[model samples]
Target: MKILKNIILISLFLTVSSCQKWLTVEPEDRSTEDQLFSSVNGFYIALNGIYTDFTNPYSYGAAWTMTTLEILAQRYNVNQEHTSYTLANYGFQEETAKRTMESIWNKAYFQIASANNILEQIEKRREIFTSPVDYALIKGEALALRAMIHFDLVRLFGPMPAQGGDNAAIPYYIENNRKTAPILSLNQVLSKAITDLENAIELLKEDPIISKGPLYSDSQLGGDYQRRYRTLRLNYFATLGLLARVQLYAGNKPSAFQHAATVITQASTWFPFIKTENIMGSSKNPDRIFSTEILFSLQAPQRQQTYLAYFAPDLDGKNILAPLSSRLDQSFENNQNDFRYTPLWASGEASGKNYRVFSKYNNIEDSRLNYNNRIPLIRLSEMYYIAAESAENPNEGLTFLNTIRNARGLVSLSELAPEQWKSEIEKEYIKEFYGEGQLFFFFKRIGKATIPDGKSVNNINMTPSKYIVPLPESETRHRN
Candidate 1:
């Protein structure tokens, strides 16, 4: 509750004027919430503000996607002097680690508060919306966003579900007030998140993505561009995908498998695998992030800046986030032909040393490419991974795993022992989600005891202290 002092203010300054740039809103004073929510356009702009906040460097734009979480997963070879070295080494109490953790915590809660505020206003001003569809879309997305943010908070700061679902996790703020919400157990938090997603799914049943597909665009949907790009927002499919992820994290394999299978069976066409020409043939401007397959993503205008700061070829060795070449090779099983390997990892010269840097998010010259300036939050491939893990049997799981392997340009596996299924899936995750920040959660979800070291060939031993991020001092200090 005390963290609300530093969190509740939502900046609604931007003006939304065009269909092409509905995400862009005009900036106004923080006290304009009443004015901002007076019209339908205000609600759109307010929701847009929450999406914009996700693009902040302190959150998904950088830390969650390409930097802090990746470092924690040992995806980078950070030196002792590097800014993220302490984070990679699990020094959660160190100053740099503390600041990073606190920033992520505060920023995530800020957006949750923003979404809560929108949810409150939308109910009171439902009459302002001319079309019933608009009301559903706006309210569905607000609920989905709140659920998604809270789920991520639980993943980061809560205990691993396999080990301690009864353990107290983060507070679940449902109201837009300074009064503190009760801190819930890990299972309780996951349950709350699932409840929100289930409600969102019902409300989003009429989501355009369900009927017209994710690419469905119309300039005349009440003259609101928010309906144009459903994929960028939390569309129906993305909500299902997040639910699958949360269910799996909570150790509910049957529910996880069911939801994941739903996304794959019904929504695969909306989010297909990237064409081979996009990555293998086009060297100048490859679709490295596989944008075509992203179920949900954020439009990060400063994605190029993120590339330069961490993964650029010119960054000093001490500062860059490149893994050892041998380690990178081992991650992909030395498979040069793998779509996710050669296209995304490239040799670069930095400080007179050659490094195999992560180029999945590197900026390209062609502005016409849709892949540019986008950071994927969820992809179709992840659904496949989840289905494989939670399938009814190992053979059924192997079939699901092969689906991803073939898409990634690898031959299908014939038969595998039951014990080998998990290791194979782990390998697929390492190859599929590099620089995307899912790898760390994958490791934590399984409660792995050792992980491949980014700096050396050895494995880094893991423990609960390393897997669980401490609650930021800012939040803990204010707790009753």
Candidate 2:
């Protein structure tokens, strides 16, 4: 593995003005590793830092969520003059696209290395944690973070499991040291990720979210406030949701169904569907992203900035990320009643032309709202999709699929032929995860030969060459 030297020194501290929050971190401090890991507060700061890093524009904040991957998924209309035009056309080898991919690669591994550092130090400083729950929460989240990053790496750079999982893919970093890690096959990397998640699930058994639910909050444990906002952290259930995602990606249908069903049956109350009042009734501050259903997300304070940068209606055609109005209408099946459609997308004029702009991440007037800054990574509706895809029978699968549809103000889908089940599920993925960036992976996983074109009425032909993103040249040159 090509390690960035600065990431190896993973010392971070928080600049909290009060005890009510612990989300902010000051990374410029150069505190010694020993001094930083001397207490449990230090561990909390380090873990929180990893979560904060995820919000950077190069990662989930923009590139992974609304820009690069979204472009690759054909979710927007990018003209030839736009900077992301090459990405929209799958030009991975272009200079600008190469830099984008390289930044994503390097940022992912940097966080992985930071997580590994915490995993290493926690054991050495175990005595500092007076409460076992504190130890488990920190260590478990670190493992989950590492696994999540590696799994995304595999999804991006590795072949689909059904296609060529035995082929060598990416390196799975497990240690904090500088020794080059060996590149492993896709299946091997997935196995390692599964192992990490299994361990995380076990360690997170003490997670209070199990008993008190995801919204549970209490006083600080060991002088740091890590217990609040369990849903925002990896917590117990989010880890399960991620495992279900990974299992489905690895083609373990039975295992995926089991894990996904567990979340649906047990945690449904914790993450209920958004009430109609929260969406249609509250026009001033609608919950467009359905924050209540978010199993895990990043607390990105800069989310409004992200909205203005890409989806704002005032941006010129080449600068904005809005889709063709007709294309977006087709994705949602032209259902005006669908909560994900009308409330989340609105008509606006940009460059003297009107378009339906994505407002899922738009700023809310009330900062105190729970959904304001959250960028969902895993959601309850996704579990239903996974279960529906992996279920043994079409009837059972349709039931799983229709639950989310009903919640989104659509009627339940009737039983369909087994051959038609995949198509139905694909439609839900397109509508449910519009800007969240799972559509490309969905197409890649199924090896779909063509997808709806974002710019026109035709379908864009696809192949493995277009599906698999090449590893950055920086890493390849190092390997050579």
Candidate 3:
């Protein structure tokens, strides 16, 4: 992992404002390491810098969170032979498509390496953190960040848990140095990721970010305002929420149900569901569900550029990423009243044609933060889906599922049977997380070979080796 470690550290160091310049830094120099992680303040700067990596052009902030992965899920519409359209059809042979998929592998590992450095330093220089609470919070966040990145990488690069149970998968790099780690089984990868999250939960239970109850708005906060922004950071509930997701991905159904239930019951205190009027409001000042429901969201400084490039409905045919009018109709089960289907969509004219755009992310800026734009990575609604899908009791599952449906202004089902679950859950995931880049994982986890595309039902088969994104050519050039 020598080459991989240097790439993450060098890339991260270069982006830090306090680092002065990217050109003057050496990746493995102990002096650089000591200067960056020597104190609590230094650690804060270093940690914030890692998060900037999370929002870079190729990672969560843009392509992975909003553009490329959504295309992979067969979500967007394609008319002419554009790149994103072909990518929706799994055009791995295309140079840019292949590079985009490869970037998911590379950028994810780079962030993982950044987290590993923090985790390692947390142990070696324990005395530097004089405040025990701060120490624990920092340690917890590093562990959670490491676990979250690895979990996604596994899903992107390997087959689902049931299919790849015993198959060899990606390496779990817990250290930043050039260690000779071999590929582990899929089961092993899930286990390592879950263990880190469980540990993070332990440390974050008393996190100062949410320790005083719900975090304050920017105007109400004092003394290190960064600590007040729990939604943007990996705080207590977000860690628990991730634990539920990781457990579900690993097929620990009962554990997944329990963790999801816990988060929904507790996290509601902070991330309460938006008011009914908010969803029914005017489109000019839309109240986005993501801004309120998110457990963790990556701040997207390049949000406007991302939207205009791929999602804006008024864009020319070559740049538009809208879904077909027919596919949008099917995804919502033809129910126009559902908040996700109607208010969250807009019809805009371009080149004498109308297109259907998902306006779930219509507005990225938070009212409280003048400049911050967050792309939701996880939200409370997903927990309800997890609880519903994983519950052993059929009635309990129906209740969980109905809660979300009802919340979205749809009628609740009087009864639901276990046999009808897979399809229903599929629809809910589609409706709940549109434009949030979760549909790909949802599709992969269910081991679906063929999925519905824009009005092209079940034409995209995703089960071949091609769906499993290849490792970056540079890394597989035999560096490991």
Clashing pairs in 2: 1-181
* lDDT tens digits by residue: candidate 2, 345-449: 877854466778888899777776778877989999999999999999877888899899999999987778777888889999999998888999999889899
Off by over 4 Å in 2: 4-20, 26-29, 216-224
User: For residues 1-480, could you state the per-residue lDDT of candidate 3 as single tens digits?
Assistant: 342443234444332121122122333454466777777766665666667778776778866667777777777776446656657666676787778767777777778877877877778889887778778877888899888888888887766765757887778888778774677778899999999999999999777645454454534445555465666678888888899999998889999999999988887777767677766774455566535777887655456667777777777766777788778888888988887777777777544556567666555333334213557888889999999999998888999999989888888886766668998999898888777778888888878877886535546656646467765565567753
Off by more than 4 A, model 3 = 1-31, 209-214, 219-221, 364-372, 455-458
RMSD of each: 2.4, 2.3, 4.2
lDDT of 1 at 189: 92
Task: Assess each prediction's global lDDT (C-alpha) against the native.
Answer: 0.85, 0.85, 0.73
Q: Worst lDDT window (10 residues) for model 2?
A: 11-20
In model 1, residue pairs whose N, Cα or C atoms come closer than 3 Å (at least 3 residues apart or on different chains), thus clashing, are 13-26, 13-27, 13-28, 14-25, 14-26, 14-27, 15-25, 15-26
Model 2 lDDT vs. the true structure? Answer: 0.85
Model 1: residues with Cα > 4 Å off, grouped in runs: 3-20, 27-31, 216-223
User: What TM value does model 2 have?
Assistant: 0.95
Quality of model 3 by C-alpha lDDT: 0.73
